[model samples]
Target: MFEKRELAREHLKFENNLFAQRLVPWPLLNAPFEGSWCVIAPGTASTPHAHHEYEIFIAMKGKARLETGGKSIDFNVGDIVHFTPGTDHSIVNDGTEPFEMYSVWWDAPMAENFLKKHVATEN
Candidate 1:
């Protein structure tokens, strides 16, 4: 079976106070699909953004809310949400504990550029 540990680790610049650790890739699978395990720390939110790719989210643990188009939908463990491409969305942890979820992307570019201009950061 295909496993995530076998896949290379790549970090994505998703949003402010948030980032994603990509675990699985489409190239590893027999078919075209990408899988990832995202860990959202407490007091943080996956920034509002959109991509030109079909996306789906499966809540694995903790409490969180999915925000899209200025509306919020509370999702818990075992909840699944499927939306089309370019649908502006983000996730926030409204609870005390960290939120974990499994995300997948299909038939689209793996990495997306959220920042247009260079912002000098103090390292």
Candidate 2:
């Protein structure tokens, strides 16, 4: 089965004062990974948080600073960032316009098992 949805503002949900929309593994689609589109208003920051899943962020628009591992890394459109499991991180939108990004995450154990199975088959 295939599930498709338009990434529009009407689909966004307000969470923690940020606008976000869950895409993959959504109600109509079941997958191993979870994905979301997030937008942070200018001069705002997402809450610092950590989880047990590995995550990657793809900057889509505007500019922001990623605060993680006690370091602040600036990122802009076309930039990609990865976070290891349990790494506390947050995005701060310091630019004049809203910051947009896509986030994809999966459990560490699930990824490890997938690699084991796929790598062995390839070998």
Q: What is the TM-score of each candidate against the true structure?
A: 0.70, 0.81
Q: List per-prediction Cα lDDT, in the order shown.
A: 0.71, 0.86
lDDT of 2 by residue, 12-117 (tens): 8988568999874455444557788999999999889999888999999999999999999998999999999999999999889999999999996666756776
Model 1 lDDT, full chain set: 0.71
Model 1 lDDT per residue over 1-123, tens place? 555453222545453456555654344334345667777778788867887778899998899999997899998999999879889988999788989888887753333211211122212
**What are the candidates' C-alpha RMSDs?**
10.8, 4.5
Q: Give the TM-score of candidate 2.
A: 0.81
| CA RMSD (A), model 2 | 4.5
Give me the candidate number with maximum lDDT.
Answer: 2
How far residue 122's Cα lies from its native spot in candidate 1, in Å, is 51
